[model samples]
Target: MSTTKTCVRSPVPTIALCFIVALFEGLDVQSAGIAGPAIAAHFGLSSSMMGAVFSASIIGLLPGALAGGWLADRLGRKRVLIVAVMIFGVFSAATAMVWSFESLLIMRFLTGVGLGAAMPNLIALASEAVEQRSHGQAVSFMYCGLPLGGALAVLISNAGLEGSWKAVFYVGGLGPLLIVPLLCLWLPESSAYRAQKGRDHSAPTRRLRVLFQQAAARPTLLLWVSYFFTLMVLYILQNWLPSLMMSQGLVRSEVGTVQVALNLGGAIGSLLMGLLMDRWRIMALIVSMYLGTVAALAGLGFSSQFYSMVVAAFAAGFFSIGSQLVLYALAPRFYPTSIRGTGVGSALAVGRLGSICGPLVAGQMLATGSGAAMVLMAATPGIVVAAAAMLLLVAGQHRNQR
Candidate 1:
């Protein structure tokens, strides 16, 4: 394995830049959802069509992640990231200018590609920036920008765009473009990548095949299972939580409050859990997070009172979202610099499939007359499976070290 320490002495600047990019990525990711009603009104989209519109970017994310990581491995993280920002930024602005439904779909799909491509690089760069001991904290700190950025999107939406949804797209688009110069001026390439490149200029042969070799097959499969189920739970909540709340007779305002609580809890969880993973017992921390996640899900499913629901939502975000951070932090450690981007990106690409599946499955279950509690209960078995996989991965890593 290439050295975890990089040529760059200070990790602060790298992490800070990655955080800015993630914040914008989060904004763009959530912008479509926030502005969905206005977009539907403008385009006269049917419910099915609007669903397609929402899924357009998500569908684009899978290929984008695969391609972005591949390019980052070959071309360099800094360059690929700039291009990704430009792709998403320009296309996001184009979304505002779109005149037809087809045009809007095209714009959003391209924007999704950009957003998808940027994430792997973000994970790779952030992980490489710090020492191995601080990898979890660094990656977690970078991830905090995601939920915080979502909060920023919410704030912009609430600022009242006068039903002009284009305004949201414009802000999401321009913010990243404005940051391009800063990235070019200040963002450092991963020295880990640089060192690996120095040793072997030849392109990685059969990168996918490499991930399964060298005793990597087990961890890689386990990581995919963890990522898939974890993200499934996350997207299920993100897309369906409001409906679940309303099903219990909560008002729109109360639902909004619960949503805010979820995001705030996610931001805190990402930051705090990352720090904790660095300092606390790894197995204990992982076990606690998964247990908290299961409990939170039950809380969301069973709680009828508003205050109890709020507390449940917060815990859900804290643990469920924190579980994602743990996976991201753990992923980079499984592969060397050569295949790290591919490994992480591939796992994320698979996870995106879960994200897409999550809401659909929840909707189907609801359509079959299942209540929120039932839906939440259905997820418990999957959570247990994900928890077990992670625990095994952590145990394997500890054994290897010993």
Candidate 2:
């Protein structure tokens, strides 16, 4: 592998830039949750209304990822990415100024569009920048920024913000706006994208159509399925874990500690998973991760003691978030650079659908008097389904290889 890890000429800098962008993504995600309560109190809104506001941004992500990925292929990754940053930054700051629930929903949805657009472009740029052997390292390491960003938002909120939820949005907004100039100066466009653009003056829609061709169809469908279930379980934990834990008689303060443990484990998991992927067989690694995740979820649901729950949370993060990074690392390899943006974006858009459903299902289950443990256990069957999809994907890849 070429160790041409240089600035302006190398991917290291681009990966670093993507990591910063991922931090903004993570920061925005946590900020909404942290601010949701204060925003509700301020507006005298019910929990359902606030939940709608939260879902608005997520709803925007589906189209954002779709349109952003499509545009990145047609226009350019760097261009789309910068515009995405600006969209989120400006609208997210505007979120602080909303006078009512409707306004808040609009701003958040707009901000989500920007975030959605940024994701596949960032992944495309980073994935294309590096050697194939190092793709996992680049993507997974870049994602470490996500959990870190979440952690940063929490710290800033707890220490810096003076009971004003808008302060979180201010920090979230300012970071990306400030990064835009630096991205323009330092972030290089994907060489693969540039090459494809040079050879084909084809319209973007034409290129997108290639993904549905016979050779691509099976893998595309399976990838979308895998992404869906993968995100379903993840968002379930992210959205409902705290509430579920508190309902289980855990003290409020301890719930915060649980989040810390989970995110900290997530960071470590991303790092380790990246290293392992570069060295191990991906199939073996993925199977290990899936089984480990099932174990962790089972443990989390079954354990009643304080220490066991915390340990389970840590293990859950280690396996689930870690596996997500692995899947992301693997995603780009499924498509040539020509439609990589579209492929990744489409899969993520599907994943967002699962994200939307995760919280809703969890809420309904809980409302119906389902135990916290059972609510979590509900994800196990989905994980098994996802694992089967992955195996089918591997089998299909082998056939293609032959």
The candidate maximizing lDDT is 1
Residue range 134-184, candidate 1, lDDT tens digits = 898899989988877766766776665675578778888999999999999
* Count of backbone collisions within predicted model 1: 0
lDDT of 1 at 173: 94
- How far is 180's C-alpha from truth in model 1 (Å)? 1.0
Clashing pairs in 1: none
Tens-place lDDT digits, model 2, residues 173-251: 9998999999999988888898789555566677667888878888888888888898889877776676678778887
Off by over 4 Å in 1: 1-8, 36-51, 97-104, 198-205, 246-252, 367-369
The per-model lDDT (C-alpha) reads 0.84, 0.82
- The true-structure Cα RMSD of candidate 1 reads 3.6
All candidates: TM-score: 0.90, 0.92
Worst 10 residues of 2 by lDDT: 154-163
